[model samples]
Target: MYKLKTKETDNSVIEFIESVDSPKKREDAYQLLDIFTETTGYKAKMWGPSIIGFGAYHYKYDSGHEGDAPLVGFSPRKAKISLYFATGDTERENLLKDFGKHTTGKACVYINKVADIHTDVLQALINQSIRFLKETYPNH
Candidate 1:
């Protein structure tokens, strides 16, 4: 059986943020903590070793793989902050137009810092991700 790596843990989100070596990154993590929590209306959670996640959902694929993951999350990484959201939402792509300096991959948005992006647009992205996940997988 295939296993998912990004499972939620009981680790402290604050502790993880504090572990960041760069003080500026730590500060940005705190700012993102506040923004993501307020946007998702859910408390922060530690996903795997590095991701600070909010709400969660359970997803299963046709190939029989399944796992639980955060509805939205971010990780303050050494290179850049990574924002996790639903992968296929056109609304998310449209909102990224005004999101400020950022790059994105499938399901992950990368920014240098919280200040590099507009918080309003970030909030909108998260909202769209949450709604998309809930509508797509209501069982979890």
Candidate 2:
């Protein structure tokens, strides 16, 4: 069986943010904490060592792999802040078109700073991710 490395922990989100090496990134992390909390209406939790996540859902794949994951999350990394959102939502792509300066991978949107992107679009992404997860994993 495969193990999920990014499981949620009892670790403190504020302590993690305070440990960020860059002062600017630390400040951006705090701002994001507020945004995600207000938008999701859930308190942030630590996912693994770095990710600050809000809300959660359990997913079981067709191959029988199952795990719990945050509905939306972010990590203030060394190069850029990686924003996590639903992986397969078409609406996510449409919103990203107007999301300002950012780059996307399979599950993360990387941005240089909070000021570089629109918070309204960020909130929309967070909400859409939560809705998609709830619909996809109704039992969770």
Candidates in order have lDDT scores of 0.93, 0.95
Local error of candidate 1 at residue 87 (angstroms) = 0.8
Candidate 1 residue spans exceeding 4 A from truth: none
Question: RMSD for each model, in Å, please?
Answer: 0.7, 0.6
Candidate 2, which segments miss by more than 4 Å at Cα? none
Q: Relative to the unseen true structure, what is the C-alpha lDDT of residue 63 in candidate 1, on a scale of 0 to 100?
A: 85
Model 1 TM-score (2 dp)? 0.97
Query: What tens-digit string does per-residue lDDT give for candidate 1 at 1-140?
Result: 67789999999999999999999999999999999998889999999999999999999889888899999999999999998999877898899999999998776999998878899898898999999999999998
Q: What RMSD value applies to candidate 2?
A: 0.6
- Summarize candidate 2's per-residue lDDT along 1-140 as a digit string, tens digits: 68899999999999999999999999999999999999999999999999999988999999999999999999999999999999898999999999999998877999999999999999999999999999999997
